[model samples]
Target: MSTSDFVETSYCLVFSNDKLRANIDTLLDRKGWRKEWEEYQGKLYLTVTAPFDLLAEEAERVKLEKKLNTQANSMARFHFSKFTHYRGYKNKMTFFSPAEQARLIWSALEDTPYSKNDFGRGVLPKFNDQFPFCTAMKSAPAFGLEDSYPLHSPWGKRRFNSNVSFRLVNLDHAVRDYFGEEVAFYFVWMLFFAKWLLIPGVLGLALYLFRPEGVTVDNSPYIPLYSLCVPIWGVFFVKFWKRHMNAVAFEWNAHDFEEEEELRPEFWGEKRISPVTGKIEVFFPEWKRYTRYFVSFLVMLPMLGIALGAMCLSLNLNNYIRDEESPLYIGTLAVFAQPGGIFAGDSPYYGYLVPTIAHSVVISILNTVYRSIAFRSTNFENHRTVEEWEKSFIVKRVIFEAFDCYLALFYIAFYRFDVVALRNELVGLFWGDELRRVGVEVIMPLLTMMFQRKRTTRKMRAEKKASNEKPIELSQAVLDAPLEEYDSFDDYLEMVIQFGYITLFASAFPLCSIISVGFVLVETMTDSLKLLYLYRRPRSRRAGGIGVWYSVMYFMVIASILTNCFILGFSSEQLMQWMPNMFKHEGGDQQFKLGYGRYVVGMVFTLEHILILLALVIEHFIPSCPRSVTTEMARRKHLAKQWLAEHEADASQQKTVQKTEHVE
Candidate 1:
């Protein structure tokens, strides 16, 4: 608490102009901190001194204040930790005093200075210099605060308070302001899907009520209606979301953010003089870049082929296991039954369950390998920006992920959901992927928490032993090491894949919406926790929109329509039975045709085309950008032109006055 015990910390505050610097100075002066200033490396460094006890106490209090406000805004009960309670007790009498505690509370509630700027047009302020202040509590070495000094939520470490309700409008603005448009776009994309997930829930309820009891492939009257509506719903949702996201981007000044041309830090090249600028720069040959691209394709194609082949094999094995007549199934059953097939015939569920579990394990391993290779491949390509790298990586990932759903749908549609024959034709597609998706959402967060706790406990033990002999200060790395790091991209990808499952295959599995709803509800909280506490803040990458993910979603929408058509037309025995046998050919001894008749094939093709055409028409009519945004842009343009004209006229008048003075 004495001056000798106090730590002096220096922070560099960068400002574009003196006005902004003065504003910061005034704000700091008001807080009653003793400070001195120095100029270093074209930046102003403000040095402040405070007792260690006071700084730590103040930092803890500020953290609690943020938590309480977030909880209040979210309409949730405050989660009280010991630090929060301690702060509460300390401020009990001071809280009512307007001069001290009120100002602190008000400051916490105020919007960040940058939040007030007009996108691309107004003065933008930033914490340009890296300074270890209150914001740097976790990383600042001088503080020596324990990694777990401020207790996080019982749920986990979070970037934001998860207990509160998330308002899309607020989140959109805040993320756009803080992290830039690229990150915000992903957030919006996930939220859009999360919000519309309710529609399917409602649809599911309606279907449940109207659907006939004991409905099978032969008896369901609502199959065609469900098929038609589900696809149309997907199309509309995409169209609506496109318009909504565009409006948000325009508002955030992210709609036109140009990608910077600077090379990424990871890019490697020899330093040389630039021909155009006459400046030294690192340069990589264009031909080498192209060669890397070719090599990447060569590497990825074989991996992709293997994955596809494995997927087919897995699907086939799954279907084969389900059939009692298949040799593979009989052989497996006999192996178990050599001990009298203990409970083999009694439990039919295990037949499908065993293969499904194996299939899940195979796919999981393949996915992990593919993702690792894809990331390395992208890095090898040496893209100049994070956006380029992400887009390239996403492309590779989407192709493999989409294959899982598309292959499943293809088999179900053309092969008439006959597992035995389809298993032989190519592998069989099953709904087990849905279970895998749900399991991942439920299990990953818990695993994250478990790992984090183990790390924290180890650190605590190490600290206790160190303290027993001699006092030691916590290093920045040690402070940060125990915390989990997360990237928004992975979270967004997970949610998008989940959305694809519900949108594309919901007709085949009505309960998909229910599962998705549950996953998303949990995901919302876990993601918030991860962002707020578990991870280091990611670098802000400005984005015009959701980039490749938008295309991915569109692909899902189209895929959904086609999938439902197949399910209704080819998979439904009732629909197939109604088709005429005019084009159906009779084979030697077989009474049924090997495949659909020409007439039925024609009907399926016609239905698919008509649905596609309808979707196109709807999309065309639905504007991608809101009318209000267009009007606002026009108004701003007009005002800008008027101001320019007036300024020019004033300059001309000033020139005339100077000419008159010279003549005199």
Candidate 2:
């Protein structure tokens, strides 16, 4: 679809009351919003458009800001906003893409000021305040007014169809145009992640499949090799992703989009003269905010402790079941393995598998409960911006999620110092918990959609029979109304945790990367399916990059360095056994006391520092913007200068023409 068509046809607003409809219409007219009204099932629907004049004005404003900022050198004392002009700014007229148009329209709606006479002057009310309930007035009051949101276009659905081949090479434009940059960045990053997994996946698989015959876990040479490679892979993965993000961001006109952050409507504080803009605005004290954060941390620390305690309990229970020397294990076998017993010999339900299943269940349950607590705690911390709020929420949730997902594996690797058990734990978590997550995310949604369709069909048939009329086909809105909202946070979190598995413990389980690659490919199709058929169209949101998730991944990259080094140097028996004979024996003595341990620690220390330095070097040498992107940026700057010069000449000519006309 064309940019104009996508922008003008995608949005919808719904209201039911006649009086409220009139009020809404009045508001739309006053705001110069263009919309077509239609009535359906007792609801008044408005198919709204981003007004052409307003869009043009916005475009011009952006262009002018760009021009002024370009002229205002970086060394200037006064602060200037860096607004990225639309792609068409080189021409005299600028045109906004669908995503930009949608962003502008949403901003206009969100910034709609309430009447001082209707709402008190002291309280700043907004258009959203009219929803759910509206105060009565002489004209009309709008109640239960649904928020404006974008509709899933037919073109979008077709473009995002998962049934098509999984070649996602150039879908970034389509995704950005339809779902906006936030969702686009996610899909792009996901595809990029899957692509990057191929190198490590294949390498790990090769090492795992072709190990020497009769090689025990303690003597395999592949373990240290694979472990050494993974942390470097992780660091490169994050660095290269940063580069790719910049390239794609430049293409999508979002390279500097985050610089224009607006104050969040939910923010509340005492009014004061803002230092940034020198305007009267609400300001929250920084010290008070930090105090609140400290208090929230104190509260959540106990919860985290509880989570760790549960993990330890699960581990202990698993050991009890797995250990044949334990009385619990003997009793379990006695009950199940009795001659002619109901369970028979080695029954499918009775095995060491029970404890692993129980452990996964415990993790799932704790994750569910802690996610809610994390959200509430973050809200109590009272961040002032969406970015701050999201970063805080993500950090809080990820800490708990990482603990839930990896605490057992860490304990097994470091505390128990068991390589075989660590490998087993990785396998169990992958097949049991990880795949279960996929089923819940993808399969449950599919089943729910099928059920909804069946119920809708039955309802249609009953109506036809009652009225003695032909059956009516279901409309898009009706089909969509029953579906749930599609939020990407859970999907992002799940993938990041999976990433941790592959990178942090790749040596313990050589197949980790390849297994994750398979899951990621499946998720590609399933996520597309959810967007196209199983959920309501998500609201478009503007994002500069993957937001704070990149930071999360970078931290994971650093942690992976430490973890993998530890695994190779101390956790892996194979590597320790390979230590030099001199290092194994105490210096100037025959005793095998602290020599090996010290040597291993020294090696780990050296390896970690080298990797950390390598990461720093990569960060320095590999520019965030690729060469092509840098060239393109320079070209755009030149074009902006040309446009500004031409514009000035035209204005001067117009002034001169007016002067001559006055003289005549």
Candidate 3:
């Protein structure tokens, strides 16, 4: 929990061969090696001081308590490492090491603080023990070798090999092993660069170029070179990562999908009312009918939060804003965003910033947290299909996201002290009370809907069976169709832009947003109220899609840019005193001058930062999407299921003939 706990608790042990002990002593004498050595089973092993000893020991004890086999316990039993997966700063005092990942399961059996008995069954109750711990050494010799064996104990190799359970292996000799010595060297090098080179390197050059105390002025030559290559380093990292994912999918044969996408509970409690007529009426249960509506309502929650914050800002600005003469700025941060934006005082853009930032950050956190919760229990037994894999992703994350976003609006509404005369006690009483009820009442049903959406699919199959139409079994039908191909620019627009935007939460004014009254307020309330009485539970989309968070920055960049221009271009009564500082502190004339150091940072922040954001948005606007790999697999799987059914029927018929022959 604290730095002291991490440092004080010694976990690792060190031992070596009698011959090696002296060598090690000489090697590590300067490196702060403490504690004594021990001999076991005629082997001189150095019990190096490691943090993972406690984890490994605890994991083993839990395994014995659960009565789980050695293998299972080993996979689950674990401890953390001193080094971090990321770079540029000191490693966290505690973090996961691959060696300890396997022992984590056994740790669970011991009723450890981190143990969760109900992982896959509830939100994520099932824990799998198949992932190997092979990546402990980045420069693993066992990697890419058929007969190569691990040198460290089995636990030491669990980190990288854990992905081996996912079956992502690269056997190609043309490219070097991903974790080979050279690759490892590069990996460390890049991390060091990411931490130190990118941000600090750029800053150093700027400081040197625009030094208040003149040292050397060589900023111009390296400017383009630095700007260009930093991105190149980033690009190589991205490509390398893609290969990493592909390798995992290949090794595990996980590319094949397991579950069809569905609204599982949508057709629950269906009724056939028409007996005499050829057409039969099926009544959808309450939640099934309003699936889209419910999803749309949830989608609009952030907007509702925005509206709430805006109103409070407006009210505050109405009374507090004393400035006059608005500036002509570009986007969300113009005069409209201030306290007065909602009323007559400031521009309307003032109230939008905080909610925008909050929304983006919340979405990112929700995207990652629930996904990990879902991912915690994956193993060979449970990870048979893509749906199972995504189960953790959808169920765990959606619930948390619903609660977090729901509460955001609640906080703003509760704290907005717009009352003319407020008794301190009753200023804001019931901000998120209704949302808290909704979160409790509806979350379970929504989560259940994820696994049980087949209610409708089965209902439809039954109807087809009874009627003249041939029955289309859902298991066979869902994966039977292929995605339509894209054609021209019109098709691209139709498929990617309009189709993508409307169905997903696409922004109307990306460069400049203006969610005005009338529909916005109505939608906000409609969305909020809908959270209570949903017809169907919606599946989780890529809630933390790069598009959404990037848009926030895009919004901020535009806002900041507009704010800069407003201050620089216009002579506002309020900001004129501050605006003078952005440029060099001018003489009596009060104008910007060339050759000043202020130009270095102020120029880059206002000019380069804005351009970078805009360019990134433009690059992202090409409208790409995941390949329809899931669609293809579903179709193939449907055909496979149908084939299997035919085979089983034929086998049954053959058995009957054999029995008849025997009787004769």
Model 2: lDDT to the true structure: 0.67
Question: Deviation in angstroms for 124 in model 1?
Answer: 32
Q: What is the C-alpha local distance difference test score of candidate 3?
A: 0.30
Ranking by lDDT: 2, 1, 3
Per-residue lDDT of 530-569 in model 2, one digit per residue for the tens? 7767877777776778978999899999999999888776
Best by TM-score: 2
lDDT by residue (tens digit), candidate 3, 1-664? 2233222222222122253244334433433333334333343323223234344344344321111122221111111221121221143222323222223322222232222221222321122111111111111221211111111222322333333322112211101121122122222222222232234234434534464554322213332333323333333333333334333332222333232332211122444665677454444443543563355446545544553454334323333222333222223433444455542333454333333333434444443444443344222113333444444334334444434432332222223211111111111111122232234334654554443445546656676778979875442112111111111111111112211111111111111111111222232233222321222111111111121222322333333333323322221111223344544434433344465446534643565465445546644652232244345445545654554465468778899999999999
Q: TM per model?
A: 0.63, 0.80, 0.25
Query: Cα deviation in Å at residue 183, candidate 2?
Result: 1.3
Worst 10 residues of 3 by lDDT: 504-513
Each candidate's root-mean-square deviation in Å? 12.9, 6.9, 26.1
Candidate 2 lDDT at 401 equals 80
Residue 97 of model 1 has an lDDT of 19
Scored against the true structure, residue 515 in model 3 reaches a CA lDDT of 14
Model 3 off-target regions past 4 Å?
Answer: 1-240, 251-291, 298-303, 306-664
- lDDT of all predictions: 0.53, 0.67, 0.30
lDDT-superior candidate, 2 or 3 = 2
For model 2, name the residue pairs that clash.
Answer: none
Report how far residue 291 has shifted in candidate 1, in Å: 3.2
